[model samples]
Target: MTLDPEDEKILTLARSARARNGTAEGAAVRDETGRTYVATDVNLPSLRLTAVQVAVATAVSSGAQGLEAAALVSDAEEPAQEDLAAVEDLGNAILFHAGLDGSLKGRYV
Candidate 1:
């Protein structure tokens, strides 16, 4: 789905972080632990992340491929148990809203 302007800006920060650093920074990446202390660091009213952190987060939220890469980079357990379903729902909503529905097939998003 296409991201809103605010989300787009935030993701831009994330992308920039990845471009600058090879991977997540400061907070640490762990397969079992998920993204520790990341929200705490970036959780501000501004809703922004350090370029370094954004890179890692962007990668994590990149969807299917991201899920695989994140699995390798660190053992982050994924978003919270509750947040997972919500995220999935959001994705579906975006698809439906964009008229892709279940018919995108190969039409290209």
Candidate 2:
């Protein structure tokens, strides 16, 4: 897919988070106001959160009213349903999935 500059930036951030943490997943989201949030999966023994969920939380905590788009870079072929639900809570937005190598795999809107 032909990603615009913003989309590319989000994907790159997500990919970098994953690589830096060496974790299962990383995610990034762009808020409606053009703010970007990035996060890696939280896998504590007492609590677990998907990367997408954490990214959405970051946006919310930063006072973003809504999201424009989201990206997840992971080894999984598709994002988990919980991740999609988190994006759904913010608003209707396309969710892009990228491989660990930073290649676009698919998108959910």
Candidate 3:
């Protein structure tokens, strides 16, 4: 599917985060107020969180009432259930999945 400019921007951020960290995944989310959050997967022994979950947490902590859209750039074909639940918690939002190279793969809403 063709992504809009904002969605493309999020995908770009997610891809860059993944590449910068050399991690398995990266994610970006745009809040209802137009703020964006980007994060890479955290796999520390004491803390393991998917990129999307981290992004959502960041948004929530930053006082975002809801999310407008979210994007995850990863090798996985689909996002984890926990990741989706995070987004769902913020309200209905679109979740875009992209390949590591930043091409659109699939989406969940």
Q: After superposition, how far is residue 81 of candidate 1 from its true place, in Å?
A: 6.5
Q: 1-109 in candidate 2: lDDT tens per residue?
A: 7999999999999999999999899999999999999999999999899999999999999999999999999989789999999999999989999999998999998
Regions of model 2 farther than 4 Å from truth: none
Pairs with steric clashes in candidate 1: 14-54, 18-55, 30-75, 30-76, 31-74, 31-75, 31-76, 32-75, 34-76, 34-77
TM-score of each: 0.26, 0.98, 0.98
Cα lDDT tens digits for candidate 3, 21-62: 999999999999999999999999999999999999999999
Error of 3 at 3 (Å): 1.0
Q: List ranges where model 1 is wrong by over 4 Å.
A: 24-109
Q: Please give the distance, in angstroms, between residue 70's alpha carbon in candidate 3 and its true position after superposition.
A: 0.3
Every candidate's lDDT: 0.28, 0.95, 0.95
- Colliding pairs, model 3: none
Q: What does the lDDT read for residue 39 in candidate 1? A: 20
Clashes of each: 10, 0, 0
